[model samples]
Target: MKKPELLVTPKSVEHIEDLISSGADAFIIGEQQFGLRLAGEFSLKQVNEATKVIHAANKKVYVAVNALFHNDRLEALDEYLMELQRIGVDSIVFGDPAVLMAVRELNITIPLHWNPETTATNWFQANYWAERGAKRAVLARELSLDEIIEIKENSQPEIEVQIHGMTCMFQSKRKLLGNYFLFRKEAMEIENRKENKNMFLHDKERKNKYPIYEDLNGTHIFSPNDMCLIDELTELFEAGIDSLKFDGILQSDDYITTVTNLYRQAIDAYFDQGEEAYEALKDDLLEKIEVIQPPLRPLDTGFIFKETVY
Candidate 1:
């Protein structure tokens, strides 16, 4: 059984040490101007400091340069990527070609992780980016378990998957929440929208309230059920994924620590004792996860088990 690297997005530079201790093998953190919907943003100086800390622990740190860039943002990008390279970031997660161009221009040696999200569903797309210098591909969350395994088997780039946490369903580059408040003639600060988790969108027919919020990039909505795959770790390990990401977005530090530890244990158990022992522990793991996760956000395997998602 291959042991995959366990990745998580830390809430802050301060949380890096704790997450490292809790068994995260790599971290994804970035600034809001360059990254979209990140769990936490760090100043360039803070990112330098973070890289040092992660290196000291013999773990990896990846900066998210994954935003859909505009013209203004591109001007500072080359400098940002250069600084990240100088500070020794393990790799960068990016969705834009501008970042690739900037990396080429600066001659930065940092590996690129292509994460175009929904478009990263097939082995061909992963290989296309691999040929262009991307070292890894963060597979789209919409992929089924079998789809993911097939990609890993066929793709040239190392495969990464989001196996846990809140999965975003929609993102728009507009202040949808703020515009709604304005339409109703209510007052609310546009910048404070991300903090307002109490706000949600109810599907008229389905009656499911999907969590919604806004930040620097735009307004975003998440799946009603959070993704949980503790029970499926054995299959993913068998598939030989390069990394497993546990998104810490919209989650507390305690929750992050608890869940990371659980997954870490599950990963070790599966490799150390094999599938039967891992299966025996799955029930206890889910029981613990349910206690920490928000009561309203039920846990499901997301699109992993679904036959058809469209």
Candidate 2:
């Protein structure tokens, strides 16, 4: 619909390099998890390792530093952020406002893409980040189609959407069952009760015994959803969005291929024939894509224009 562009956002540079070798136009490299070091490029000797390889293949790279980090980690982040800037990382995607401001303070900068986990849903929110110096903002996974269009129309920065992969239930960085699993199991004697709620179990059977995470207001829920946007590619492009992204760090190559093919075919078909062309190929498209894990709730269109879910 709009100019066809593909952004390969790998969990790290290894997968990104692999995707580049395969056929990705751009990359988003995040090193925070590994302590803020570029994966492939080791030292000054490997100066060109990241930039040269990707540039040689005619690809772009966006270094994601940290969506969430403490004030203490700022000095540690400087060197990594500086390296990305010096190497001219195409853009930077971050969730923390402090990180955003710190990058600007670096004096050497490029496009700053807001991480979706930060939740810029409405255009006013999107544009707020734009004015604060973000180049592109990944629309929140919860936004509806209409909301996406509205964001595109109003936000000054370029917009990108995650068209495929696991949709996270909590902020990318948050306390989780990781602690609940660790502490609750060991210290709580109730977990060892002869007849119990079975809270130790990972999966549920009966609704009454269901393991629901309770928040102050209610229960906080998280489920995996396969994002297959092939059916709506045309409308999105026509809406003036800039990029389509895929989420597949946990998927196999075949899964990635299937996701890629459907979107690619949908885009190609729209220009070649009409909207009907993609519809004609819809069955095969749907067939190629299968959900490894469906949301416990059900398949949702996602928040392109409305609230995440009722």
Candidate 3:
């Protein structure tokens, strides 16, 4: 079986060198002004410098411009994209059709990676983007391994899947966190300062608590548990996944290094030895991952084995 490339999200410029050294095949960098990852944003100069560092190491960098665009941001968007192409970015990851349209209209030659949030759940949607000029499609987190296999067998574009890290359960353009707190203060007639704070939502029946935060893009509710598919590396590779993405844009450097290294080791083991030897390394991998991940933060295989109901 062919070994899949490991794609990682760097928390900052300081974290770039370690990630590259940890056997990451590519790095996904984003800026706060235009990308979805507000916390892990890098300045343009920083990104340009980082691109040089990554290129020197013979790796690739994909800039995340995966934000929904409004009419006002078009001119700036066009200019920024030109700057990215000039910097020699490998491709741009996008979720908005308008942004895709803008790229075509401006005649930007950089390859586009389509990630239409949760819409890429089947082969038809994957092929639709492929036909429209997307070089790759990041499959939805909601897909099962069986579904992904079918899509890969049928789709034309390269396939990318989130093999590990935090899975977002809800995303909204509205400032739900800020508005909720404001309404509470008003209804109770209390004076309070507007501050951005991390909040949690509790589920009595399931006894689960999920993290909620707001940033430039909007409010986001993430799954209580981070996704971990270390044990499934062999299966994913066999399924023809072109790339495996590790989502840790908001996590610590240790988290990024440990996860990337673990996946790197796992992938190497699979290709070097085979399935049985790879299975033997799972316990060690999980233990190392547990040490670096946040205390009490749960981990699971996400929806890879089970189906999700609408």
Q: Write the per-residue lDDT of candidate 2 for residues 1-310, one digit (tens) a residue.
A: 4565676554333444566654566765554331221222233223336667777778786766534566667786666677777777677777777777677688756777887453666788778888888888788777778878888888888888877664555432332434454566643542343232123224544431122232211222343345567666767868878878875543455555455556666666776677788778866666556453322323334554345444
Q: TM-score ranking from best to worst? A: 1, 3, 2
Q: Write the per-residue lDDT of candidate 1 for residues 84-164, one digit (tens) a residue.
A: 888889999998988988889889898999998878889999999999999999999998899999999999999999999
The Cα RMSD of model 1 versus the native structure comes to 1.5
TM-score, predicted candidate 1 vs. hidden true structure: 0.96
RMSD of each: 1.5, 6.8, 2.6
Cα TM-score of candidate 2 = 0.74
Which 10 consecutive positions of candidate 3 have the poorest summed lDDT? 187-196
Candidates sorted by lDDT, descending order? 1, 3, 2
List lDDT for all candidates, in order. Answer: 0.88, 0.59, 0.83
lDDT of 3: 0.83
lDDT for 141 in candidate 3 is 90
For residue 111, model 3's alpha carbon misses the true position, in angstroms, by 1.1
Candidate 3 at residue 106, lDDT? Answer: 77
Candidate 2, residue 286: the lDDT equals 62
What is the lDDT, from 0 to 100, of the residue 181 in candidate 1?
A: 79
The number of the candidate with the highest lDDT is: 1
- Model 3 lDDT tens row, 85-132: 889899999988877887888788889999876778998888998899
Q: Which segments of model 1 are wrong by more than 4 Å?
A: 188-197
